[model samples]
Target: MSSSPFPDTDLAGNDARVGDGRNLDSILRIPVLMQVVLGSATMPVADLMKLGRGAVVPLDHRVGEPVDVMVNGRVIARGEIVIVEEDNSRFGVSLTEVVGPSAADQNT
Candidate 1:
C-alpha cells in the first residue's frame, strides 16, 4: 500500500484499521441530523401570529436557487433540489458544492 501523509490513528495514537484489529466502527455508526434548507424569512411576532391557511410567506431565495444542506445545524454543502428519477413522487438534493468549514462559516 502507498504511504499516507496522515495515517489514521485512534485516541491512543494506534492504527485505525479493520485487519481484524482496532477500528472506528462504533464512531462511524453515530447518527447526525441532516437538513435541507430552501430559505428563510423573518417576520414580527404579530405578523407571524396573523398567518393562517392559504397565507404565503415569501422566502429570501428565489426559484432554481441552491439550497443549504446542513448537518447538525452546520451548513455542510449547497445543492439544488431535484426529483428522484426512480421515484417521481420524491424529491432529492443534487449536491453541487461541498463547503469546507472555516472561521468565516462560524457565523453562518
Candidate 2:
C-alpha cells in the first residue's frame, strides 16, 4: 500500500545505490538493465534499399562526437569511442560523465 523506500531510480529498472559491499552483492543479484545500441540516423526506404557491399551509410554522429547513451529511451550519459584492437575485435567505450535524472522527470 505504501511507496517503496528505494523506489527504482534507474530508467534501466536496475536497483538503486546499495550503501555497502554486502548490500552491493545483493544489488548485483538484481537483473541488470537491458540495453540496445542504435546509431542515430534517418534514411528513406529508397535510399535504404540502394545499399550494397562497401556502401557508406553515414551516421549523424561525427568522429569524437559524444555517443548518445540511453537508458530506456532516456539520455543518461555520453562517452567517446575506444578501439580495443586495431584489427577485428570489439570496440570499447568509456563513459566520460553520468547525467543525473532530468528535472522534468524528478519526483518531488
Candidate 3:
C-alpha cells in the first residue's frame, strides 16, 4: 500500500482524517466575503451625472425577485431578502438555491 503525500492529520495534530468531521470543521471557520446582489442599471454619462439626493434609479429586477449571492466575486447561490426576525429590525438572505461550480462559471 502507498501513503498519500498529504497527511490526514489536522492542524490540532489529531488523526482528523479526510472526509471526517474534523477536516471540515477547520475549513468552515475560515471567513469569506459574502455579497448580495440586488440588481444593476446602465445609463449614459449625461443621465448618470444628473443623479442627486433622493434620485430613484430603476433596476432590472423586481421587488420580489431572487437575488444573486456572491462569494469572492463569484455567484455561488441565489436567495431572497428576509427579516432576521419577526421584529423586522435586521435583514438577512434566505437561500433559495445553491449554485454548482459549473453554473457559477456561466454566471461570472
> What lDDT would candidate 2 get against the real structure?
0.69
Which regions of candidate 3 fall more than 4 Å away from where they truly are?
Answer: 1-27, 103-108
For model 1, the run of ten residues with the poorest summed lDDT? 18-27
| lDDT for each candidate structure | 0.90, 0.69, 0.88
Model 2 residue runs over 4 Å out of place are 1-27, 33-38, 85-88
True-vs-predicted CA distance for residue 9, candidate 3, Å: 11
Name the runs in model 1 displaced over 4 angstroms: 1-21, 104-108
Cα error, candidate 3, residue 93 (Å): 0.9
* Candidate 2: clashing pairs of residues: none
Candidate 3 lDDT, 21-107, residue by residue in tens: 756776888999989999999999999999999999999999999999999988899999999887788899999999889954669
Best by TM-score: 1
For each candidate, what TM-score against the reference?
0.75, 0.59, 0.67
Model 2, backbone clash pairs (residues 3+ apart or across chains), number: 0
Order the numbered candidates by lDDT, best leading: 1, 3, 2
After TM-score superposition, what is the CA distance of residue 98 in candidate 3 from its true location, in Å? 0.6
What is the C-alpha lDDT profile of model 1 across 1-108, one tens digit per residue?
439876676578777766744565866788999999999999999999999999999999999999999999999999999999999999999999999988887687
* Preferred candidate (lDDT higher): 1 or 2: 1
Count the clashes in each prediction: 0, 0, 0
